[model samples]
Target: MEPVAENKRGLMPGGVAKRRFKLSAGDIIFSILNYIFFTLFTLICVFPFYYLFINTISDNELVRTGQIKWYPVGIHFNNYISLVNVNSLGTSVLVSVGRTILGTSFMVAASAFVGYLVTKKEMWGRRFIYRLFIVTMYFNAGLIPWYMNMSMLGLTNNFWGYVIPGIVAPFNIILVKTYIESIPSELEESAFIDGAGYLTIFTRIIWPLSKPILATIAIFGAVGHWNSFTDSMILMSGKPELYTLQYRLYIYLTSTSNLSALMNSGGSVNTSVLNSVLNARTVKLTVAMVTILPILLVYPFMQRYFIKGIMIGAVKG
Candidate 1:
């Protein structure tokens, strides 16, 4: 008998034949088109930040003339170094970071607890309370009344002003509620049968299960708190110590004198050289980069949860 012919494709260690899979022509074309589309889309989204960064690091004179684009030219650290001269820089960073942490925590906790409470059939006036929350999303008193309320509550010029008002965000609560409703009710029932209290069920089972939505709301809260300067602008008018990073950046943008003073603070530098390489434009770009970098750094870590949470939470709503 003739020896059995060997397969052109070699067998695996387990003696399973390795199959070669080839993409169809349509699939290959579709994949190429998808890659091209996404590549262009990514570039579009990223160019603004890249443009800002390069302009900040590039020669201020060249940047001012609009010659610097797509890459750095005659790069120097002066733009960054000059930022140290802003007396409020360190305090503003601390205030922004502190508020982001505290505010996000408070918002997430409030959203989760309220979200969970509203889902229960046994909770008193759950429907009316939930409807009230929904109603807040559609209506608001004007800025004057809002400010008066804050002043009456004595939140004016207070750090808590940044955090407390954001605690009952109806939108976030709705997202959390929708997501929580998707959780299996059997899990809570089982916990209840085992002598678990409502608080225990929430802390142990519901909270852990709801991590995706919680993280989503956390990202929202963090971004909102980090980017918000209007509240600080209105409430902390006389209190520079409580001014957030965004508010400080706004002040710098609107005040060329402030930027000039900061640039001049670079000790012992030749006045002409400072004037040449450091200007309001470069300073503004550098400040923008600084303000946005933290959030950019943080968003990647939570992106998976963000997408998942938003998708699941939005499914019902």
Candidate 2:
């Protein structure tokens, strides 16, 4: 008998040809359907922002008439340009930037440190303290009492109000604590053997290792600070200089007279033409675009860490 012909495909242990895997018709159909579904989903999610954007750039006259859907018509940048003329716009932008940076930094550092501390077996009442932190996440004093607390603390109209009250974010601490627990205790033990103090080990070792979760916390804190106008509305009502970008934008969007005044403030632009070119519709859309741009720009940079941190941090908690 002729020797068995060697299989052209890879052989199994018994010298039988291995079956090649292939997608069935159902899989191909499912894949096509999946692609279609996600594509439609993506467009649905993205269309509002695109619509907002086109309206801001389109002819204000056409925008007001709702004729600028799907694509921009008679595109002009007058809406954005007119914002520069709004009083305190520049100051509000600075205040917003300042609060976001400082608030995020303080929140991240406080969360990291508190998270690390709670992981220590030596700390007395560590579990109690951590549980207390978690409790705040579920409970809140009414707005009236909260406002009273802020006023009593003299945080109202104070820049520190934005930073200080949010420093110890309970949810962030929980995430950080859970993430830190997943780290090898051997590392901390080794540091302890090397005459390293808790602070040194934390600052030198834990901090670096905790970047993923810290970044997640930072994004959360920054977005909270950037988007929060209610705090500004309540606390900084007396302090226009401390007004945030969101608060200023909120005021402009709600007040037609403010929009008109903003257009008129641009002396170089003829009032008659400017009024038609930069109306309430265009200004509202433009402010919405401006308010959203910073978070959009920043989110992509931290998304990888955010995903990884959330997944790992959430594993235990």
Candidate 3:
């Protein structure tokens, strides 16, 4: 039997039956042992999430009374119910969604343009420019400088503060550049000879051909934006209305005496200390679900690109 390329119903190019990856007796035994170990590993990885799910929606009374330790003793909707009533939290979620979308779009566009430029042999100062961006990834400016810069830029208390800061990833630019380099240069040359400008070639040829890698970038940047809290925590001091969901949830969970005060911000009494713990748990779950859902949903579509991009990027200059 030939070792076949998946999705193509054919043998190896030479048509000789392809080499097979066969197992010896010891290999078979080890393979089985590895699978069993990995199965247990997988279960271990998922078990914590299962615990979180069950405990999050569990009755607080049951949890406090020690009737439930690892799983829900009684299911109740109040955990989610309490969360649904907070204006600041709701505002935060919307802001986070907006920030993720807005920041990702900006990142994609900027990275795309920069990546295209960096890939061109004709561009002067390309090496310098690429290095300039890449250096920041290794040595970041301190937090105080970043905060003061934001203040100087008047991004403080502004919704754009969170959305604008992270749009250009030097690493992402490199990834896109590498993937673009993998594309046959002849097509671009032909486009250039046919009177296509950089914008036209990029918009017409590169973008459509590069959707898979773009999707990969979108997933990366969007997850970063969605999970981000520290920047918003530092910068968005005055604007409760503009707080990202993660930051608001962090404060809600950590602020013990302020639960009632936070609850009152929305004119909702659903945040008493007893109920707030449950809310905190639900917030944890909600954040887990929300942060992951987009990546999970988009993953299937971009699987090929996700793999191909790495392969393409790995090729030496």
- Stretches of candidate 2 exceeding 4 Å from the true structure: 1-20, 257-278
In angstroms, give how far residue 176 of model 3 lies from its true place.
1.4
User: lDDT of candidate 1 vs native?
Assistant: 0.88
Model 3: ten consecutive residues of lowest lDDT = 4-13
RMSD in Å for candidate 2, one decimal?
5.9
Give RMSD (Å) of candidate 1 vs. truth. 5.6
lDDT of each: 0.88, 0.88, 0.77
Could you say which candidate leads in lDDT?
Answer: 1
lDDT score for candidate 2 against the true structure: 0.88
Question: How does residue 288 of candidate 1 score in lDDT?
Answer: 89
Error of 3 at 207 (Å): 1.9
Task: Give the candidates in order of lDDT, highest first.
Answer: 1, 2, 3
Report the C-alpha lDDT of model 3 over 58-97, residue by residue, as the tens digit. 7766654556656677788665666677657778878988
What C-alpha lDDT does candidate 3 achieve relative to the native structure?
0.77
Give the lDDT of residue 222 in candidate 2: 93
